[model samples]
Target: MTVAPRIAIDAMGGDDGLPVMIEGAARALGEDPALRFLLVGDEAALAAALSARPALAAATEIRAAADVIAGSDKPSQAIRRARTSSMGLAIDAVKGGAADAAVSGGNTGALMAMAKLALRTMSGIDRPALAALLPTLGDNDLVMLDLGANTECDANNLVEFAVMGAAYARAVMGLAAPRVRLLNIGVEELKGTDEVRDAAALLRGATDLPLRFDGFIEADRLGRGEADVIVSDGFTGNIALKSVEGTARFITDLLRRAFTSSLRSKAGFVLSRPAFHMLKTHLDPNNHNGAVFLGLNGVVVKSHGGADAGGVANAIGVAAKLVRADIARRIADDLAHFRAGPRTAVAAK
Candidate 1:
């Protein structure tokens, strides 16, 4: 018999609050009947919301939480309310082994801070990184890491991100060995800062790693799917991610305007409706909604704050999938091998 994966949800964390979270959980439960939830939020509001979601209600158990960490709250402010806040309690459920993983559509900084404090780093991992899947030209999505979790990262950090990111690709992308690359201004080893070059040199020689360490990738080629995993410091990764999102939106809007500009264009759009619908589905943010904090002892998935029910369901799905796949163990094993194999080689040479 397969054991059901349990997820702890920060019900009041996102812009849509409990209603969307509940609806999302309901949708997820409908798809995965064996799934269960530990919903952390205000008891009265959650109960009221869950009444309409009988399937979700049956699979959920509300854990009362009085406070919510607001979107504007700083990490320092959020840590103080860790015990009382909905997001914090949801994380706690994972720490306490009450749930397999925690999913939240909340303040990213706060969630990272609280999760780090609560779960700490797995042995040998210095810092946790936020990783997510991005649609690429390939049949499979590519994994990118340090997505605003650590604004600054050193060479060692970048190498660690590669190991962790590759493990993530293995778990989610179903790749046996993902091709990893360092995101840089240029592909040449001579380009980029000391940190990136150093990280690249290390990855290039780390024969023990299961992943293929491609030298570098420029931001312009990210969607080409040339690499399976792209590693970057949070500052660079966040900017690149936003740039891609903006470009997608711009193209979508341009198509909309073009289709409405003339009867001829409208007729063309009608003829190509199926292709356009496929494009829309492929580019939709909801399909890739979860961003995971890797290197933590427990799994923590971040949902986009403004995501709708479909997006929220996708995030929950990601969390549940990671739990079932034992992603934490995979990362730990890979990190252990990485640390033991090339501890002195990267920096020494």
Candidate 2:
């Protein structure tokens, strides 16, 4: 009999405390009945929270964590406290074979440091990437990587990200052959840094991989919904991700202000309420709450720190999908094939 995936959660990681964490776990359990949780935090607090929801409490196994990692804690400092902290314990559960995956809504830097130090990168992976799906105008969401993990990356790293991102796309997005692209200054062949250009060249030559390389793509076209997987160094990727998020918020805020500006505007808003609701849903960060650290030896999903129960549940959903799909194995297999070297088949000709 196949066993259900058990997830280890950092019960004290996020901006919100115990109640939100427990409620989120309950919500996720409600969605996926087969999922079991290993909640790591203050045992007494967890027990009290779980008492009201006996169903979640029964499905959960609470582990004691004496400390919580602060949002301002540096990665180096967080690493030192890994043994007793809630985030640390949750990751430890995954490492020790108690859980299939770990989820935390904590300091991104600290989480990366702890997860890397604990789980280590998969074989042939130099650095693990933080990948998240972004809203797009097309039928499917776009997968962008290295959101804030490795500030600088080489050609080989970008190539590796493409392979891992493609596997991730298949696992989460259900895309059999995801179209991959590098974030660049221009779509032209001569654009971007040496690393970006070289990675593009390498990807163009590797048609054997289970992905379709679509060459370079300008950052401006990221949300047009054409590309499936986008690769970039963490420095550039983080900036782009923030810019996109800021733009979304600006638009949303502007819309709200305009709608409430006057009686006429309010009437107009009511007339187009359904369309506005769709737009609001599309721009909701909670809808895209999970960011996975790809290329890790095991699965570790990072939830937005300010996420609500619904957002936390969505993040858990991302982790569950990865565990069920055996995404780590798929990435390992792809890396093995890719490391064997690409054929001399450059589509750029």
Candidate 3:
């Protein structure tokens, strides 16, 4: 029998740390018997949580780590001071080969900082981008990257993002020749700032790439399934991503209120219950629980700060899938090819 990959989870990292993460770990272990978990955090609290589950007693192990990185602490200082913070300890497990991958639901900036310092980046990847899967109108989801990892990116950096995003789409999403686009203010060739223009030129010239480059896509068209992978600077990408999430929540809440307005409406809601549930699954942030810091030497999945047990479970699942797929190695191979060419710059006209 094949042994399941061991995943190290930061049990004291997120807002709902001990309860939610512990619950999620137990649930994941139950679903996959071969799965092994290295729970890193306050040993006493973790032991208390796991004590109820006798079945998981054998599959799960706890690592004692005293410090907890606060969300407000500076990333560098936190990393230095909290040698045993849940996030730091989880990364250490990966480094020590005690875990195949690490998942954490904590401060985004701190996570990135710890990951880069701990794992480093692959060759040719100047910086790693936080790539997230966003729901689209079609059956397949869209991949967006640099989601607040590096706010100020150059043209070459954007091109690198395109390459990494493409690999993620193909490997993770199982897309063949995934359609790629640059996120911009307008769809015109000459739109936004000089950086966009230069990046467009670079991508246009690189038709020999394995993936399909579909040119610029406006932020408004993101959800319309125009492209499988969208690339942009971290600042803009973060804003666009958060806006979509906020809007989805707002619309869902409005619909819920409308459906429960009166007896007639309530009857209609019951009739359409299945469809509503489907919609909820598609739009729910909990369902799309993990974001990968792509281009890193090791797999590091960042979960939502507010993630519950379901979300944490989903994150562990994502980490396992990514490790099994050998995503980091695939990315390294793709980057080697891209960088082997005559390094071309997106020149300003």
How many pairs collide in each candidate, listed in order?
Answer: 0, 0, 0
Consecutive 10-residue window with the lowest summed lDDT within model 1: 338-347
**TM-score ranking of the models:** 2, 1, 3
Using TM-score as the yardstick, the better of models 1 and 2 is: 2
Residue 136, candidate 2: C-alpha displacement in angstroms: 1.1
Cα error, residue 304 of model 2, in Å, equals 0.1
On residues 18-114, what C-alpha lDDT tens digit does candidate 3 reach at each position? 7888888877777777788898989988888778877766888999989888889888787784466888989878877888889999888888888
- Candidate 2 lDDT tens digits, 163-214: 9999999999999899999999999999989999989889988867889999
**lDDT of each residue in 1-349, candidate 1, tens digit only:** 1169899999999998888899899888888899999999999999988887788888999999999999999999999999999999999999998998999999999999999999999888888999999999988898999988888999989999999999998888789889999999998779999999999887877878779997899998998989999999999999999999999999999989999999999999999999998998999999999999999999999999999999999999988888877888888888777767754565576
Clashes, model 2? 0
Q: Which residue pairs show backbone clashes in model 1?
A: none
Against the true structure, candidate 1 has what lDDT?
A: 0.91
Task: Give the TM-score (vs. native) of candidate 3.
Answer: 0.92
Candidate 1 TM-score over all chains jointly: 0.95
> Which stretches of model 3 miss by more than 4 angstroms?
1-3, 260-263, 342-349
Instruction: Identify the runs in model 1 with alpha carbons over 4 angstroms from their true place.
Output: none
